[model samples]
Target: MATKRPRRQAVSTCPCGLAETYEGCCGRFHRDEAAAPTAEALMRSRYSAFVRRDEPYLLRTWHPRTRPGRLDLDPGMRWTGLEILATTDGTPFHTTGTVTFRASFRGGTLHERSRFERVDGAWVYVDGDFPAA
Candidate 1:
């Protein structure tokens, strides 16, 4: 009979480049313990979700109009870090906003300007545009 090996506990850090632990940062959003207060927060949580491969969270936070029927994550690609470059109008009072960031992975960096909108008082990712090479 084969025995199940014990799962190792991995050290957690916020993939969004926040100075807090994963649980204190993006983990709360992933577990539905809290809603992101701003568009930037939502973006951070979404990036963290990509790193953790939390497909459900990503789908939940994505706007219905832009969300795909399913998500396909690249298993061989490892996310390394995130750098928020700039944000515009993503405040608590704004209905729409944009976030420009650089998400570094194993191969290279993905630079994008993502658009967001508040749906029913909750920020949701709408879409994004990659910078021209």
Candidate 2:
């Protein structure tokens, strides 16, 4: 069937700079209501799942042994900026944390250092580091 792509509303509040928006920042982790308190809010919800290309919410917010069972994610590359270069609090945040960011994708541009996990207390997305320039 493959016909379902219309559920995005909370627009223009967090394009991944994180001042809080997109329905009060990442729409509380896409309406799960809170989770992602750092690594720039899971790099602003992985740049809002690459600006709403979603891809099963970027493979269910990844982190399953570096998740990658199936993902083509090719919709014309178009996420153009973010730079949060520095943070440390992986292995359960001390009140939550993470930052290291440099997402500017087009044909190729990746430099991450993401790893966030707070689970029961919120904050998810527990692994990342795409450095191979």
Candidate 3:
């Protein structure tokens, strides 16, 4: 019997340990065509956005009703890693979804469960609850 080869996670390309290209992984969400399959994907893409300093894309993906008036990333803060615990949907094809993640920051760490909604053929981040740091 032949054994299947193990899949490799891309360490160089993605901040997350997924054996996929940046373009194939989080970049898809930034692009207009591809839709995230789950909340984890969305969360990963969002993390990548922070790394890439793509605030515009962040705003684009954010749910407008709950979106802040402006987007600003801390200048000195360095994002270390991302750990997604669970997800609901958060895909382009879904109506509603949730993503729970632990993101490491320089000042401290952030653990949040973000909610997303798809309305009128667009996916947007709605809200999130964070644990006390």
Cα lDDT for residue 81, candidate 1: 93
Cand. 2 TM to true fold: 0.29
Off by over 4 Å in 2: 1-41, 44-48, 55-84, 107-120, 124-133
Model 1 per-residue lDDT tens digits across residues 22-87: 999999999999999999999999999999999999999999999999999988879999999999
Q: Which candidate has the top score in lDDT?
A: 1
Over the stretch 1-133, how does candidate 2's per-residue lDDT look in tens digits?
A: 8999999875566777767767777766766676665556666776787777777766776666667887887787788777777777743437555667777767656787777655556555667667665
Model 1 off-target regions past 4 Å?
1-11
Clashes of 1: 0
lDDT by residue for model 3 (1-133), tens: 9999999974567765477878778877787568665656766887888877889878887877877877879777798888888787666556788888888877778899888777666656778998565
Report the number of the highest-TM-score candidate: 1
By TM-score, the better pick of 2 and 3 is 3
